[model samples]
Target: MFTSREGVTLDSIAAPLRRWLLNPVLTVPAALVLSGFATATPNTDSIKFLVPVCALVLAGVLLSLNDYLDKQFANNWVSDNTWNWDEEIVVVTGGSVGIGASICDQLLARNSRTRIVVIDYAPLGWQPKQEETRLSYYQCDLSDSNALRSTCERIRSEVGHPTVLFNNAGLVRGVSIMDGSYGDIEATVRTNLIAPMLLAKEFLPEMVKRDHGHILHTGSLSCVTPPALIADYAATKAGLLALHKALQLELKNIHNAPRVRLTIGIFSFIRTALISGHTNVPNFLLPLLHVDTVGEAMVSAVYSGYGSTIYLPGFNRVASTLRGGPEWFFRILREATANFRINFRGRHEVDSQTGKILKA
Candidate 1:
C-alpha cells in the first residue's frame, strides 16, 4: 500500500530543497553562481571576474545541450500532438520476470488504449495487479532464432505491429571467464545481444514505413564501470549501449525516420529476481533501485515519446561523465565500493575437490 500525500511535515517542506540540491541541472548552475559571487569583490582582480564569467557561460551552454540531448532520439513525442497511448502497442521481451514484469505492470496501470505483448519462454508465476484487458503473453524463447521468428509472426497476426519494443530480456551466469563454459558465453550473447537485433529486423521496417516507433534498450551501469566478475554479462550490456547508439543514428540520418526513437536505460543494481543473488555497493551509499521507480520512468517515456539514456537514482548521470577518466580509477573505485559481495558470485555450490564454482 502507498501512503497518501495529504499530510505535510518538516521533511515534506524540505523535499523541494533536497531535490534541487541533488539535481545536476540545478547543481551546475548553483556552482557557477557561487563561483561568480566569490569574484564580485573589490579586489580589482580581472582574472577572477573573467574566469567566473566564462565558467557561467560554459555551464549555461552545457545545460542547454543536455536539454537538447534529452530529445536526441526523436522529435516524435511532442506534448501538443494528437498522439496518445490509446494508439500504441507495447512489446516487452523477458517480460515474465523481474524488471520486465515491473515495466508491464506500469504500462497496464495507465489503463489506456495501448495494447501490450509479453514474449518469454518462462511461464509467469505472478499476474499483473491491474487486471488488464489490453495485455497478452506469447511463449517465445528469445534466444532461439527460429522460436523468435515464429512467435513474432504470430504476434503480428494476432495483435498488430508493436509500436514500442523494450529489449529487456537478460541473464547473468556470475562466473569469471576462466570458470565459465562456451555454452554459457553463447547463451548470454544470444539472449542479451542477438535477440534484440532479430527483433529489430523483424519489426523496424514497418516502423520506418510509418515513421513511428520507440526502442528501449535496457543497459546497465556495468557497461561503464565493469566489475571483475560477470564478464559475459557486462559484455552483452555494453553491446546494448553500442547497438542503441548505432540504431538511433540509422533511424535518424540514413532512414530519415527521425521520429523513430531509441532510448538507452543505464541503471545500477535494481532490486529484482533477475539479479537477486548478485552483490551490490554498500546500501548506505547506493540503495538498491526500486522496481516502482524504474517502472514509472519507463511508462513516462513511452507515453511522452522521447528517448535518451536514463540513469537510475537520477544522480547516476555522473556515471556517463566519469567514463572519460582513466580505466584504473574505475577499477580501484569498484574494488573499494562494491567489492563486498564480489566473492559471493553464483549460487552456494562450490566444487569440494577443486574449490571452483560447481554450476556455471
Candidate 2:
C-alpha cells in the first residue's frame, strides 16, 4: 500500500502519532482510569494496560487525519515554481557533509544548469562529480560577520545573487553544560542560531527586490524538546524555530513578500558524523534517518513552495505539543531518553579536515 513517493508522507502520519501517545497528559489520564478499574476489580492489570494502547490507536487516527489535510493543501495550494532549479542560483552553507552534503548532491542532480554555490570551510569527501562548471565552493566561517560578508560578496559576483539559500550549517558539542567550555557553547550558538539570522539579513533584501526566492532553515528535534546534555544546542535550535516563524510572519504579513518562501526543517537524529557514536535508542521509537531521506524531504518542501515546519520520522509534531507539559515531567522523560550513546570506536572515523566519516 506504500509507494516510494508517498513514503515520507506516510512517515509524517506515523511519527507524530507515536510522539503524541507518549505525552504525560494523555498517559496520566489513561493510567488513572486503569488504576480505578483495577482497584474495583482487584485483577484488572490487563484491562488497565489497554488505556495506553487505546490512546496510541486514537493518536494514530488523528495523525492520519492531519496528513490527509496536509496532502490536500500541498497538492492544490502550494506553488511549484520554487522547484525550477534551472532558473535559480542555489547557495548552501555547511554543504561539506552529512545532511548539507546530501542536499547539495540532490540539488546538483536535479538540474545541470543550476548554479550551485557551497559555502563551507573545507570539502566534503564526496563531491558532486557532475556539473563541475555549475558548482563552486567558498571557504569561510559563517559565524564571523567579516568572513560572511566577504563570502556573500564573492558569491554574488560569481554565481549571481542566490535565489535559493539553505542555512543548513549546525554544530553540537556533545557534552553537558557543566562539562562544556564557554567557547563550545558560543560556537554552537554562533553557527546554529546567529548565522541564519545574519544570512537572512544579507540575502533576503535582494530576494525581495527580485520578488522571488526560497529560504530553508534546518532546525532540530531539540528545538521542540530540549535534551539534557546539549543545553546550548537546544537553546540555539529553539531560537531558530522562533526566528523562522517571526521571519515568515514578517515576510508574508507585513512585507507582502509572499513569493519569498521560508521553510523550517524540524528533523530528528540522522545517521551522520554528528551522531556517529550513539546507537542504543530503539529503532522504532527514534530511527536513525538516512541522509538521502533528509535531502529528499528538504527538496520536496522547497519544490512544493509551501512554507512548512517539517518533522522527519513523523513523530516530531507530537514532541512539539508535549513541550507544553510541566517541566518536572519533561525533565524525567528527557533523562530517560538520554541513555543512548554511540560506540565511537566501532563506527566510521570522521576526518579532521572534511568532517566526513570514512565509510568502513
Candidate 3:
C-alpha cells in the first residue's frame, strides 16, 4: 500500500472512506446526501435514511463551525499573510529523536525552501541526505538554564531568528514522587517545563516585534489525567499546559502580539522511546499514537498561519470538558487509570549538580 506523509494510505478506497468518516467536514457524505435527495423515491425508507443522514450532517456542521470559530478567535480574528516559507527559520527542541525528529522531517517534506534548526543534547540519529542543505543541528543540554540561554543566543546569532519554535523536547522519570532522586525531579522539570519557557523568552520578543511567529508545544494528556508512578512527569506536563495558556494571554494582552500564533498539542501516550516500557491496558481504546500522525498535525497547524488547540485522535477533547465536571467524576477517572503502570525502560542516573546523565 501507499502511505503518504501524513500516514494515510491512498492505495485503496478504504483510506478516503476512513478519512471522510473521521473528518468533521463530511464532504463525501454531504455529496452523497445531495445524490440521495435527487434520486430518492417518495417512500418511508427514504425518510428514515434522510432523517439520520440529516442529523449527522447537522452534527458535522456544528463541529465544523466550532473548529472555524476556535481557529479565528485563537488568531485574534486576523489572518497573517507574512509567512514566507523561503525565509522562515524553524527551531525544534529534542529534534534528534522521537516526536521531535518526526516534526523536523514533516516540516522539511512540506516545504523545500523552509530551514530547520534542531537543538538537542544528543547527536542527530540519522544522517541527513546530501541535498538536504536547509537543516542545521545544534547540540545543547536544555535542562541547565545557563546552557539553554547560551544555546539560544548562539542559535539567533548563527542561524538567524527562528520564526517557528517547536518546544518538543521532554523527559519522564517513571518513578513515584518519593522514589525519584532530586536530580531526576529537577531534570524532568527543567527539560519539560523550564526549557520551553526559557526558549520562548529567547525567541518570543523578536516574534512579537515582527507580530508573526508560531510556538507549538507538545503537551500531554497527563496534564488533566495524572496517573500514578510518574508524579514528576505529570507535574511538569501540567505546568507546561498552564504556561501555554498564560503565554497565549500575555502574547495578546501584554505583548500586543496577537499574530504570534500559540498552539499546544495535548496528546495521549505516543509510540516512542520516551514511553518505552509503559504499556496501556486495554490498548485498543488508548492506543499509542504514531509519531508522524502528531508531527503532521503540528506542522499543518503552523502552515495554516493560525493558532490552535490540537487534541490528537480527536476524542481526547473530552479531557477539557472533564476538567470542569464534578469532583467525583474526576476522582473516578484518576483511580481507574492509576494502575496503568509506567516502567520507563530508559531511566538513567543523572549528576546531582548538572542534571546530566551519569549512568544508563
Candidate 4:
C-alpha cells in the first residue's frame, strides 16, 4: 500500500535517520535494547550506557558499507587492464627525493615502458639508469609563476601531456609565525597551494580532452589538524585538500567525466629526505612510516580510479574524526605530543638562485 510519494519520503528520511542512529550520542540506548534478549548480564546500569555505544559502532559499520558501495560503483566496469601499464606516463613534482622519488622508482620498476618525468630544483644522489631515455628531469622552481608556466610548456612539447600528474611539491619552514619572514610564508603557500592549482589549470584541459587521466595530490594530516608552529604550511595543505575535493565533485557529478580520477592523500610522518635533518619522533603514537609504504599507498590509490581521500597508517582516520572537538582539547593534545618539539637540524635556508638547500 505504499505510494510513490511515500516511498520518496522514506528515502529522503532514511539517510539522516541512519546517520543519527550511528552517532555516539545514541550508543547507550542501543546497548540496553540488546540486553533484553540476554538472560544474565553485568550491572543493568552499565548495560544502559553500553547499548548506545554498540548502536554507534553499528552505525559506523553501516556507513563504511555505504562508502564501499559508492566506491565500487565508481570503479565499476573498469578492469585492472584499464591502467595501461605499457603507456602509463607519470609526472611527479619535487621528485628529486623523499616520497616522490620512491613513487617514481616503483612506477619505473613495474613497467619498463613507463616514462617518468621528475620536476625539481635539485638532483637526488641516485638517478634512474634509463634517465636519458625513459626518465627525464626538469629543473624548475614551483614557486615562480613564469618558471612553472615555461616548465609546463616544455614538458608538453618534450614528453607529451602527462597521464598521471602528482602535485607533490611542498615546503615546511620550521620558524614560528613571529620568527618566520614574509618570504617564508609566501614561498610555502606559493609552492604548496598555488603551484598545484596552476599546474592543474594548465594540464587538466589536455586530460579532459583525452578522456583519461589521474591527478594525485599530497595533502597533509596538518590540513585536518593545523599545528600552531606550522600555521602557514598547514593552511596551504588545507587549501590543497579543499581544491582536490572541489575538483573531484566537478569532474564526477557535474561534468560526468568518469575516466578522470582525482585522489588526495592525507598522511602523517613518512621517512623521507625532506625530514632527514629532523630528529626522530617517538614511535609510540606518531611513528614514521617507510617512504616506500607511502609511495605504494599513493600508487594504489591512483589505480583504484575512484575519487577518494586516503589516510595513511589507518589511525589517521580516527585522528581526523576527533579534529572536530574543542580547540583547547586539540591544543593540549598537540602540546603533549612529540610533534611539538623544534629539533630540525637540516639546513633551513636554500640558495636563492637554485632553490637547493644551502650547506651550513
Query: Between candidates 3 and 4, which one is better according to lDDT?
Result: 3
**Candidate 4 per-residue C-alpha lDDT over 1-360 given as tens digits, one digit per residue, 9 for 90 to 100:** 211221333323444665666644465455656565332656546566555567577777777777778676544334233667667778899888887888888777666678888988766545775544488899888888899999999999998888889998787775577877776677777888999999998888877777688889988887876656678888999999899878876765776666777788888766654454332444444546677777887877876655567776555677787778888887765665444544322334654444433331
lDDT scores for all predictions?
0.70, 0.72, 0.79, 0.71
Reference-based TM-score of each model: 0.77, 0.75, 0.87, 0.74
Which residue pairs come into collision in candidate 3?
none
lDDT of 1 by residue, 1-360 (tens): 111122333333434644544455666666666556666753655445556555655655676676676674245334324346776888998788777888888887776457889987677646767543687899776767888999989999999998899998877666778877676666677778999999988999988888888888888887877776677888899988889888877877799787777787888777665555434554433456677767667777767767766776444567667667877875666675455454424232333333332332
- Tens-digit lDDT track for model 2 on 1-360? 222322434564544555666444565567667767877887757575866666765665676668667654433333545456677888888888877888888877776778888887656547676845488888777656778888998888877888888999876767687876666666667777888898888889888776678899888887766666777888998998899878866876677676787788888777776667554766655667888888988977877666677887666777777779888877776676567674222223333334332331
Question: What is residue 176's positional error in candidate 4, in angstroms?
Answer: 1.6
Candidate 2, run of 10 with poorest lDDT: 343-352
TM-score-based ranking, best first?
A: 3, 1, 2, 4
Task: Provide the RMSD of all predictions against the true structure, rounded to 1 decimal.
Answer: 7.1, 9.7, 3.9, 11.1
Error of 4 at 118 (Å): 0.5
Which residue runs does candidate 3 get wrong by more than 4 Å? 1-44, 130-132, 278-280, 345-348
Candidate 1 vs candidate 4, TM-score winner? 1
- Lowest lDDT block of 10, candidate 1: 1-10
- TM-score-superior candidate, 1 or 3: 3
Once model 1 is optimally superposed onto the true structure by TM-score, how far is the C-alpha of residue 11 displaced, in angstroms? 16
Model 4 scores a C-alpha lDDT of 0.71
Q: Which candidate's TM-score is highest?
A: 3
Model 2: lDDT to the true structure: 0.72
Q: lDDT at 320 for candidate 1? A: 69
